[model samples]
Target chain A: MALNLFEDKGCPLDRQRFTWKELVQPPISKLDDDAFTRVRVILMNGMEMEAIRFSHGCARMNRKWQLPLAQLRIVEQHQATMINGLLGADHSILETTIAYEQVAIEVTAAVAQNEPDEYLAQVYRFGMLEDFDHLYRYSAMLDRLEGKDANNILQCYTDIVPGRPTIVEHRAPQDNLREHYDRLRAAPITKLHALTIMSSEQQTQNFYLNVAPLYADPVVRQLYTEIASIEEQHVTQYESIIDPKETWLEKWLLHEANEVYNYYSCVQQETNPRIKAIWERCLDYELGHLQVAMNMFKQYERRDPAEILPGDLPEPIKFESQREFVRRILNQEVDLRALGTQFVNKSQEGVESQQYRQHLNASGSPTDMVAAGYEWFAGTELARDGEITREKYTRGHKITH
Target chain B: MDKTTVLGKNRSGIDISPIDIKEMMALAKVTPASSSGDEQAIAQMRQEYIAGADVLGSVPLPSTLKGMASTAMEKLMGKSPEGFIDKLGCRLAFERTGVRLYDALITKCSAAPMGAHIPLDRLHEFRNEEFQHFKLVENVIRSIGADPTAQTPSADVDGVISLGLIQVLTDPRTSVAHCLEAMLTAELADNDGWRMLIMLAEKMGMEDMARDFQQALREEDEHLVSIRQWFKEMVIKDTVGT
Candidate 1:
């Protein structure tokens, strides 16, 4: 390992704040190689913290909750400073938009890879295809509105292909729920995975909600609104997987352990020393938080921390490529959907559609507008994937106007 | 159905493997319980097996070599599990490489001197997009009841390609122009992967899947556009300075 991540001492609260000068330092190069993944590690951490910080405003915490909440705010602010310093001013909203999409892709995969249950994995896959399409739709906007190519930054690691069309992704809220895992017996990683993915998707939804109004183009704004709705459904899908039986204190403990575990991961895989230091520092801060949370759990729940957490955190999570794995799944299970705890193919009867028409009637499909915009400007309905994998998956499907 | 039978069941006894469970659930004929009075008990035991302990039961997880071997054995035995597992492995590997590439690029950009003109934020955005793709691919893999960590032949191909990109970062002499070129290679492969997937899904009668894959491919085309533009910018800047 490059460095041990479980050490206790962190930068004191007095030292966590960075000067404006430091925050404005040069952003990482577009070609530095580790820049995006490093940002992902940071962002993933941020998302989890944000989710954990707010999910437990339960009556049980009383005033004692204020302490951890204050601690969370300090650490969160420091994390924001670190990320802002890394971002600099050179990026545009379009760029941030693209990065947001990438975060969704990478983090969702990380959780899916770590998830032990097939049903939970299926819930994620349904949303994955929708976001994949969002990236493509937004790429079209980047080209049409800015007269700029989307690939300048994409660099071909992700194929900007369509997934389950955004047009059909919207569904009734009640339909989104999947069966919850048994908290007592479920893998700690699975709970952590659910929390991680839920927050990441929530962030994506919030990003679109925040930025949609900023865009001048109607289509751009509409696409954001359209996709943001799907993300809302995704949040519901992922959150429903958590066992509701666990006490808020138990959830808090898992949150802290999860934070430590993720920071440990970033420390292990980080190649850049500068970024690695940030991860290392944050890991310590999170460990402190974990210690505090552990004590609270013991006092409140009257249970050993080990009762909820595994003896040792499982191997640190890795964010590696899943190219073949995705392709294999696309071939076999592309048509599957969630029903109760089991995943069934599209042909199964419980696949409800009553609410879809009303939803579509409320607003003309933004996905249609996206396709129309592409046709009007690019003379084609679909953008090409270029030289990555062959565009062979959608061949027999109809391409409607 | 008894607690003894349930508790005594080996952790591995419930076969919830995506492939096996899917196939078993689809069977039309259930041997009408032997006319014995034990039929009700047997049926209840089966129901409990499916609903209660099946998910908790442990089974061998997916790994690259094991997935490959499982795939091969299924084919040999004429009982192929869904072939999606292998394809997802390839995508997961490629998306990770994409995320790493963007991260490296972002780090370098952030460290560049104040005087060095760079689109630092644009690079950050690109990295984010790749991360999203990474998540999407993994989600697809898990949806099919396989772990995304597994390696396969196609995934290895992606790994080898990413190895080359890492080489560019390691060598101090390689400049932004060289990195751009490496990115171009990655993008081309990504485009092909999406295109191929879309076509494959369509052919398999998965119209809904095809539409979604099409949406992703559109964004991929834009990725090619930006990468090509960035490369041109780097070349122009390099020529002027040199």
Candidate 2:
């Protein structure tokens, strides 16, 4: 059933309140819970984080709207806390990192398939491949460092293989931009997809930046630094695709509708009953937020919210294995590179990005060093019980240091 | 679910995801590594950094007063006092962390559904001994006029190492056998830490401190034996249904 935007008034912002105990609910079981639950938790946290960020940005620009944005921002913060707090203490940082990459690969793959505009979809596929490679690098790190398997977190829903290699994912700032979708002509789902992925990548960028220094190992630290730089480029690339000409109120209305749409998607597919309820409550809250935004649109812009939003929410984002889609993209576009807002063949990649990457890798690429001839086995690389293939196997491998 | 170990939807293995694993292995085989070489590349990069890296940090001067610290260093030893001080600091930190590990283990045991005949009283006895050992180390550091609260480089490293053990003990999902193994790890390290302190104290001519450490080492030996035994018993019982 499609959710009608205007008919369902939802719980108003003032009524949307959470106690500390309510905010800090019991975490999902690391070993037993579905991996997609963690994916939803991570993605929604990204959503709430963006909500707070946009609210603060909007408040700074529109002085008269500061109070309403403040009210909305507080709710968003608690929502983020409640959602993110569900990731249990049992997850080591590296384990949680594997889950983060799963979100990047699986969720981005889903979005890439659904995006309406060909150029924007290409942008997503290009970025998705980069993040897919990141999953492989992080998986190898987890196996070698912590003596754990990434599949434990991934649950075999997403494959632990390389895609467009992270070393080649780096790009010059100018080369990273993509053409923005026309706000007037673009499908509502296209707008939501842009916001969702950009928010996700931005959260990943901040996550890598925040946790990078906590690592004791130099290579681990460098790997995070390198990936975090790519996530920054991803953010730049993703955000540039959102139409910049939308008015402040117009953008705010779209943000609310996107939140409602995402929570609706989560509510539709969430498997765990407790987590599903959380999604349902959040869905109602987002609809309420949409109402508030609608009122503001009327008062501030004197326009109907339907001008930017759909009468019915679009089909929910699919929460399933994107293995076949990802494998196809990997086979076809692994060599594609960004060239001035356009994806191009590896040979056609501009000299500027190539030179930038060379300088960065001058000391040796950590992503390369960490995953050298790395292969993911069921248990881990170490799970090859008694097999010893030394010296001869590593011969002719790349990267001297 | 009450059993610590069960055969269920343990999707982490190849059995449930045989098709996916096969596909993944095939893809990985065909895909060339992004960069090059082997694990040696990481070791080589790490070697360069390790060559240039500084030590963790310095031990605090006695009471953090420079003049008093110099005097305290003299009191602790006339020869190689920093080495002795660093090891003593390490012991102090480990003993303290050991108490907390026991606190977590006891809580986990009570909450555990299988709560096998774990000797809670004996666990208490062990926990108190750890606290006593911590107090002893604290007094020894103070007697040598070094600040017991100061974190030496060795202490910092011990903290980093104990993180995994603490994580295992405190986690609710870990079983009795799992936590017992974690406790065994702590006890084993704690035993060696005490023995090392005793050796260092004797080497530095601190006979009284050496004697104090010898007593702590004896208690730590008991802890190691008991944890190892319990871990063995639990794993065997869970596996063999004995």
By lDDT, the best candidate is 2
Which residue ranges in model 1 land beyond 4 Å of their true spot?
A1-25, A38-42, A48-61, A338-342, A349-354, A361-363, A372-401, B1-242
Using all chains and alpha carbons, the TM-scores for the candidates as numbered come to 0.56, 0.92
Interface RMSD of each: 26.6, 1.7
Candidate 2 structure quality by residue, lDDT tens digits, B133-195: 999989878866778988999999999999989888876667878888989988888887887
lDDT of 2: 0.87
After superposing candidate 2 on the true structure, give the runs of residues whose Cα lies further than 4 Å from its correct spot. Answer: A383-401, B63-76, B112-116
**For candidate 1, lDDT tens digit of each residue in B1-242?**
00101123121111313343333223212212111232233234345445644221232244433544433233223323235455556776887788788777666555555413557777777777777777877775555446776676677757765876877754444556666778888889899988887766655555765786677778778777888887777676555533
Tens digit of lDDT per residue, candidate 1, span A1-401?
33222344344444555566654444554444443453454465455545445544543366767766566666665565665456533345666676667666666666666678877777776666666667666765665556554444443334444445566666655667788889988887888788777777777777779889976445567668888888888888877888989888888777777777777777777776777776777777676677677777888778888778765667776655444455455456556654544566666625454356455647455555444324111111123323123344444233431
Docking class of 1: incorrect
Model 2 chain A: lowest-lDDT 10 consecutive positions: A384-393
Candidate 2: residue pairs that collide: A397-B37, A398-B36, A398-B37
